[model samples]
Target: MMKDLQNKTIGVFFGGQNPEHEISIITGEFVIAELRKMGLKVIAVYIDKNGIWYSNKKISELKFFQKDYAKKLENLSSCYLDLTLSRNKLVLHCNKFLSRKKIDIDFVFPTFHGLYGEDGTIQGLTEFFHVPYAGCGVYASSVSIDKGLTKKLLSSLNIPTTDFIISYRHEFTSNDDSLIFKIKRKLTFPVFVKPARAGSSIGITKVKNADELKVALALAFHYDTKIIVENSVENIVDLTCAVLSDGSKIVTSDVQESVFGSSDLFDYSMKYLEDGGAQTGNAESNLIIPANISNKHTEKIKEYSKHIFKEIDASGTIRVDFLLNKKTGELYANEINTLPGTLYHHLWEKTGYQINEVLEKMLLQGYARWRESKEIHKDFKTDVLNNANQLKLQHHSE
Candidate 1:
């Protein structure tokens, strides 16, 4: 590992337009704190509910973001990543009269949970700028964010996954009865309706009958244009495993079983609003570490978790959720979170690695990946532009 990153300036981006905005803030703050403790120069980048990007040193402290910081906004500056090849920097500009300033960020750690932040948008920006950033790349983020797409891909690969049906907003508005009828005919009752491209259980509902299904679909549609209705596993238990990938080697953490307190399923409150919520331990949904399961089952989940990490081409840290059918003894891959809450550091800690250790490793790995990318041959030996001109002449003759 590289000995020092003292000179490097790292940007921690958190909060977004999605429903999980507050949760993202907490996650971002936690990461910022960790980076600071490591004696590194950290920049706190906040994305508000309006999707406006701002940078402020005050953001490094949790108090500054507990409520609306409108009064303090004047001190902060609006910023955007400068993707121009000339520089891999963050451009912060405010008034037209003031000259624009640029901050060179050695690395970016995105803590945004859903939508634009975690769904490859931020990663795409970093990749386009040729900057090193932690977490999954564009392809992995895009593939894992869409629940319907994840199910299809996993099922196609012969990976166990619950059966699901997808519905678009237009189709629902045009013919609700048709979509409802198809779902009922294809799957049994007690299904889950969720926004296809959502996280933190922001827009999810459990439906026991057709009437409830309609209501759930309406709620889910409000959050996303596309919705997914999946067969709910009976007498099921939720399990999650964290995966960390560094180049060729991939490591999976101990399995965790999430137990709900007041709800039958893990919802938004259980995930973010509860005691110590996602920032530290269990949160509202008490998580059992090294999940109580047979040794064989434990190994199976870990194996599947590692496989999904590789299959998605994921880097950095990823949390893979699993659902086990109590009656059938079947374990199904639920979803992959490219940027899991708190980076699932709690799980890793229980598995023998501290949060800081993981973060440092990830930073080094990200830098190495960036350096390796620079060595790749991007230009072709053949003169493609000249050949294109000849092709144009040939096309004119034809």
Candidate 2:
């Protein structure tokens, strides 16, 4: 089955109208390179920030983007996913009068990070086109993006999470005092405010007082209408684990500690914009594999990771983050990255597997899941439509 998949064409999609667009481009390039190494026919599908889709061989190389090749119209061609076709295909054209080109794709490897990309938008599109996608489905992607909703879902399963308060933009703007008073009354000082639906820690702030909270709320609201404020955990250490499933069995990777050292918080600056340049693709270098935690903690994190993946019905490779107290042994799940940066390739690599092997497993798993979905009885053999009755209209005729 896996060998047969190597013969199919894969569409590598990246770049979107989100803050993580640049990172998505890097990830897309990495994925395209890895897929090509497996001797598969891969097509580059680049979606610019303006939501314009372009397909061309030149778009597959990173040097093209480094030189701003997208701005040159002659170097690229406009393309769109044709949903009218039975299979997922990319339609390329110069103009309506010109002959259009079509590229048939059997699978899609979406590398979108935030907003429409990871928030179920791209996954929904793949479903409409009837193609096997490489990550979570629409339901899981949408649910995982909302921090508040993810916490609620985990809490229902008896999972631990920090106490949080949800703040809406309208309420914060209408009466700032009332909202702040409620937050202070319910939670203590030194809270973390984050955009409800965002990635890369784009709009996150740690507030130590009411004055700081006000500024943090403004920044967070700028990114998303909904915001989540959680009581800061004492002596917190970031830990992350990745899970992969083949629709039946699920496996987890080793726990990796995110060492922030003296930094107050792991903001966007620390993750990407620090040092010389962006560290989006090289983030794994900062992680400490087999995190210096107790065996009990490691086992617990692995179990929780698998449980959360199954609970959310996530497919492909998904990474789950956690906040563990160094002083205490308490652990809480932070959030689930449906499409983690670099596909969490480092975590899987630590488990004694190469990138190609891991990706092949994901592709086979996604295809198997897609095939299983087709086995379900979507259209029941019922006569409800044929046995329907007509109703008379009861309205004044003009």
- Displacement of residue 130 (Cα, Å) in model 2 is 1.6
Count backbone overlaps in model 1. 0
In model 2, which range of ten residues has the least summed lDDT? 389-398
What tens digits encode model 1's per-residue C-alpha lDDT throughout 1-398? 44546787888999888988877888899899998888889988888777677776777788997776766765677776554532454544433236665666767889998899899998888877777888888999999999998999899878898888989999889999999999999988889999999988878998899988778889999999998999998788889988986676789999998887456688877676677664356572477888877788789989988888888888889998999886788999999898888888889998999988788777877777788888998877787666578777889999
Each candidate's TM vs. the true structure? 0.92, 0.93
Q: What is candidate 2's lDDT per residue for 88-142, written digit by digit as tens?
A: 4333343223567777778888999989889999888777766787888999999
Task: Judge candidate 2 against the unseen true structure and give its global Cα lDDT, from 0 to 1.
Answer: 0.83
Question: Model 1 off-target regions past 4 Å?
Answer: 81-86, 94-101, 282-285, 381-384, 387-398
Residue 89 of model 2 has an lDDT of 39
lDDT accuracy of residue 261 in candidate 2: 77
RMSD of 2: 2.6
